[model samples]
Target: MTSDRITLLIVDDHPVVRDGLRGMFAAADGFEVLGEAADGVEAVRLTGELDPDVVLMDLRMPGGGGVAAIMELTRAGARAKVLVLTTYDTDSDTLPAIEAGATGYLLKDAPRDELFTAVRAAAEGRTVLSPAVASRLVSRVRAPGGAPGKEPLSAREREVLALVAKGTPNREIARELFISEATVKTHLTHLYAKLGVKDRAAAVATAYDRGILG
Candidate 1:
């Protein structure tokens, strides 16, 4: 929780994965590895004790699962943001973690730069989703499952949201659509309001849940 460095708690059941992440963050600038957890139960305990700025969490573990840990952390009002770093990007995996209050979702194959960006965003209380995870959301939206009636999003907002789902930054999205950055932010805000979400990750998950991206 220092102002200068973003502290992290890496949570995974695999020793190799935890070791790699610890070394990676250690080699990176502006980040500090506070601790590591082998399972959700340990993750929760260390999270409460270390109070890391962000938790790089894995979904499946023997001792406890990530979704349950995230729910517990959210319920307890922990200050750490959970950024799910897993191998699975399926609907069942991504949707539940996002719904459980994860600040971001990223697959294990994510590039180092993308992972760093997502971690920084999560630390800043912003939501981030890897392109693959976002693509999965799009796929889910295209699937045949919709509840009765949900509020509609404007076409422009939908476009913005789609870009957000792909992990596009506001500037890049604006450039792609020939819009200003402020305009991109405005569209994001409107869409967030319509979707009842606070950030990009939640917005994408809600879009999938409501079948809005279709």
Candidate 2:
């Protein structure tokens, strides 16, 4: 509810994306688009110069990747909050950017309102994540040993997890497996314990991340 306008620097390798974002933010109230950069190196330089409140950063670039820029920004104690705006939602992409000090992670497919909300939250130094990214992170923390380990999932559990990854509901999974709903729920609980997750989405993310599912 602060009356001050939030400043932003849009960093992306694609010119079309930059133009679209710049236009979107320009049309929206309470935000000012400071500048645009096509690579991480330029992004870093601009961030230093503009000192924007939030930086909409893309992951992959030619000169330097977003993760590297994020790390550099953190090391340099830059004031802008980096909000990763990328198409990748996998652990390989999300984990590194976050660990490198990105303030938030959002997918390119997010709704315009969601993007605005994420930027606002990031400007205030709050953590924001796309739903898929959040589930992946939660799955990582809940996974046994905090990552893929030697404790392998059981064959039945693997089957259930595979179906879950395919967006199958418990009832559907049970019907397909010729098992009762209660049995499916039991299998899910056991798998959750073994995988160190609390929900279906997290289980799927952890499975994919751990190579339990392709």
lDDT of 2 by residue, 123-185 (tens): 877667665786677644664544533467788878888877655567788999899989989
Model 1 per-residue lDDT tens digits across residues 69-109: 99999999999999999999888899889879898888999
Computed on alpha carbons, the lDDT of every model, listed in order, comes to 0.85, 0.84
Q: Name the weakest run of 10 consecutive residues (lDDT summed) in model 2.
A: 142-151
Look at candidate 2 and tell me the lDDT of residue 157: 79
lDDT of 2 at 117: 84
Task: Score candidate 1 by lDDT.
Answer: 0.85
Clashing pairs in 2: 142-196
Q: For residue 115, what is the lDDT in candidate 1?
A: 90
- Model 1 residue 57 lDDT? 97
